[model samples]
Target: MIRKDRAVVWGRFVRTRSGLRHHHPMTRKIEEAQPTWFRLSEESWNEIREAYRNGATAKELAVRWKVSPSSIYRHAWEGGWSKKRSADADARAHAEAIAEEERADQTRPDPEAGLFGPPGADDEAMLGDPAALAEQAMAASVRAMRARLFVEAEKLARLSEAYGRMAEKRGGPAVTIETIDLETLYDIVMNKDGRVGERFRVDPDDPGPRDPILVRYWSHRYAEREAFKEQIRRVRANARKAACRAVGLDPDAPLPGF
Candidate 1:
């Protein structure tokens, strides 16, 4: 039996009257009075130790277990729990993130398929011949570029025509310039005429001798289009040379089946 003010600490009751005392076994000190805080059961204390070792913070465990954070820290120190649990948690999280990124990469779409379109049965058949594979890749790349150029050129023409109509309403020239069709522009650019200069020429400062704003707009876009085409050309050339070198062939020599 115990009084209201008297309580048990470690199964030893506090004194109900003066001059009666209890002592701690390890500390070997006479107990002054029952502490204000409550004690956790052995099972709960064991769980707290395990949680602390596995990266749970003392304050977090204290809140969850309804104990003082100081008690949690004291118990951890007594139990020899590692203080480097936070660092271990961070390392674990970093490893998981890297694994997740690798998993995402495995499921990601291929850029080559997106750009040059999916390979056909014939392209699959050319896998054994590196030079043939390189040629096929280049051909696919050129076809894709041509298709994109046609679409963009048509869009530019429509924009130019719309601008012309708007100009007419403002009492200006009805059309700023003649809108060239995609085929005519392709021929003019590909033929390398003096007016065009080169196949992949990109001179921003000089939109050429053409006076029309249409030519200037086309010139700007053409430079961008040619830049992409040149990149493809360079990539193909390099890939072909690499393929040749891999087979112990002369890289500077003419490519096979050229």
Candidate 2:
């Protein structure tokens, strides 16, 4: 009985020892799997070297070393690692510099802004408001009409003298002068005398009868005078239209065609 009990105790001890030996490698692996921050006793450089040898990435080495990726890159460089990673970093930095320069250029002021001068000044003012521009045009047209009227009046006076002279030379009745409304004036000027010497005249030196020239000149002068008066009438009509428009009246209403 004593021999059998000793055999049992020896067998139990052998089994326990074998089990411990089997679990030892697994325990070492588990310890290795723990985070590097918890395994603080190991040197960071040594850890990096061991991790790199085991095919670890730079980011993994950075985390394990508790340092930046740039630090890992520096160490890799000093240790004669691949230069491709460094070249990639250089290319990235150059790209960033070019992007920054482009952004600055896009934010610069436009060159065209200076050539036309500053906003809200004389250059802008000359464009003129609609009402003021209309008034100025009307005034200029009235002045032109007045000048045309002066020229026509002088011609009419000459025609009156010529008619008196012709009547005296032919011993006939003197020509009559009449005042008529705007409608009659246009009709008479357009239809009278076949637009002969009354409308236009040849130069005095030209080989033509003075009577035909005088008749054509007078006719043309009359037409031109009527046209000038018509323009004045139209201007007045427009002024009235503008006034009516200011007062919210319809500008195209049948007041006059003028």
Best by TM-score: 1
RMSD (CA, Å), each prediction = 24.3, 30.0
Candidate 2 residues lying further than 4 Å off, grouped into runs, are 1-210, 254-258
lDDT of 2: 0.56
lDDT of every model, 2 decimals: 0.64, 0.56
- Cα-based TM-score, every candidate: 0.26, 0.18
With candidate 2 superimposed using the best TM-score fit, by how many Å does residue 43's alpha carbon deviate from the native? 99
Q: List candidate 1 segments past 4 Å from native.
A: 1-66, 78-80, 85-93, 110-116, 120-258
- Model 2 Cα lDDT, one tens digit per residue, 34-104: 23323334375766755664567777665545555566677777886554545676678889999999999
Compare the candidates by lDDT and give the number of the best one.
1
